[model samples]
Target: MPSSKPAFFFSSTQSVDNRLGDVFSFIWGSYAGLRELWWQVRGFNTQFPDLHISEIENKFLAGLPMPGGIDFKKLFVKTDWAEHEKDFSRWILFDVCTLYEGWAEKVCKDLFSSSTYERNAKAIQFPSGVRANRQVSGYPVAVNEANTSASTLMKDEFLPTLKKSYLNCWSFIDQHLLAYRFFKECRNSFIHSEGVVTQDIIDKHTELATIQAVKPSPFRNNFILPSQTLGQSIELNLKDCINFATIVRKLICTFDAALSVAMASEAILEQRIRNLVSNNPKWNNLPSDPAKREQRVHRMLAASRIPEPQNFANMMAWMQSKGII
Candidate 1:
């Protein structure tokens, strides 16, 4: 099986995390199921040597539900199982790439929407110390070379939006950001180049990484595709997918732990809530009394979504802790 032990990946950001989990589960579930079928068919044949393999396969597939838009018969014939398993692994990594980028983009948009922050994030000046790739401090990002990644999203969109002092809190669990992007480069090749290893992906390999922290991933070497394999179709096997998925999950967990703590603090969350309440004129017609107005605001906030901070325990906890409605 291509699966490791089940992982429970979540940020305090339930909305985004849940979506990520759902996508991860669906792709992984299908990958394991394909391999599981491969083994089960052989095991069943061992028990009943006289029976035809075709009969056993038909019986097994008949028991499984056939969803719309899928041609299971043509897709999963006797000879197709090996290729099918390989295909699932390829897609699993591809899907993982999409999930990581989507979640990062969503969080980036949410965190930067506060009215108190500069409207033009590019205008904000981040300190040199923050950008410098120091020992275990921060990894250098290659936004120009790569298509999309956690490092790219943070460097290009999210980090610029935050105040300069808060940069210390923004640490990555993954030290080798370029090594991580190599997997994403494979993902892009699959997407735009139709699974063929392109010149672009080969060029980015091994050399594209700018920051190699003192403690980089042991799998850092895995990011480099052999130069000989260029121009050929990507040979994404089960092990490759296992590595890709593990790294993506680790990054998400690390990001969630750090950002959730920052979000819980008064300096960030309070300003976010203030921005939300102050900017929009939607609550102009509240009750005249102070107590009634406070009650109404909490009620309204509960019903509507909290856009900033990206994740939270609840609105009430934040309201009581921060002394804001």
Candidate 2:
């Protein structure tokens, strides 16, 4: 019941390792694009004559030719140029508008729709597929659909499961969300406008300084620094987003582990009671007094080797009766 399966940190470690590569590329690519864009956007009138389109694009392009053949699909999922800046012309501003508000909406949608992420996709269900009739095209269509699907996924699958896990890890959730929101706001400001992003802004908006003030966790909390900020110009990069995405995936896995363990523990308890009922045959009508039943369970658990919590017996019984175990 305590999970014979190994800790998810193995998967987490591998995921983080792969994610770091994406994040690193994203950061470098984003910064290159941001630097180029800044000169064009802010220096358009003054430097337009000197700016070369190919040079600017090439500077940030990272020499990774437009993905083709077998690598296209994988590359798209790992990092998208449209979402990143090189494909600005292809980006649907309206769809970007939705993600600028919240990461959960987009992240959840990707989880559900991507066949490649089958484990996550299977978690979401379509309720009658009523919206299936709608037909749309273009980047806007895809983005809008993704948003809708993500919202449904969050409501039907993520929210209920996450809430249950959150009960066990509320403090972590709160701090993470705070940091996420800060990143979102700061990211939007720099990406959307020519405004300068300063270290202070990143610190205050990201709450990195505030978080640093608090005691650190056993795990290294790698502080995220915005790549776009300069003394006078803001540079946009994709690394931060990828890193944040990596963090979200880790959180989901962590929650899944906890949920599985909790379910397994209850299952073990339920089986124990059922075995008792079948073996003794008199367990069904043994006692009607709730107080006495609780006391019996308390004493039995106390005598056992495992140090269970006070309400564990009641929880186990409830799960058994509901067949949830």
> Judged by lDDT, which candidate is best?
1
lDDT of 1 at 202: 67
Pairs of residues at least 3 apart in sequence or in different chains that clash in candidate 2: 26-239, 27-239, 228-235
Error of 1 at 146 (Å): 22
TM-score of each: 0.51, 0.31
Estimate the overall C-alpha local distance difference test score of candidate 2.
0.40
Q: Clash totals for all models, in order? A: 0, 3
Q: How close is candidate 2 to the true structure, as a TM-score?
A: 0.31
User: In candidate 2, which residue ranges exceed 4 Å CA deviation?
Assistant: 1-169, 194-203, 217-219, 224-232, 235-243, 253-325
Candidate 2, 76-120: lDDT as tens digits: 223444444533311222223233223323333333345423332
Q: Cα RMSD for candidate 2?
A: 16.5
lDDT score, residue 276, model 2? 54
Clashes of 2: 3
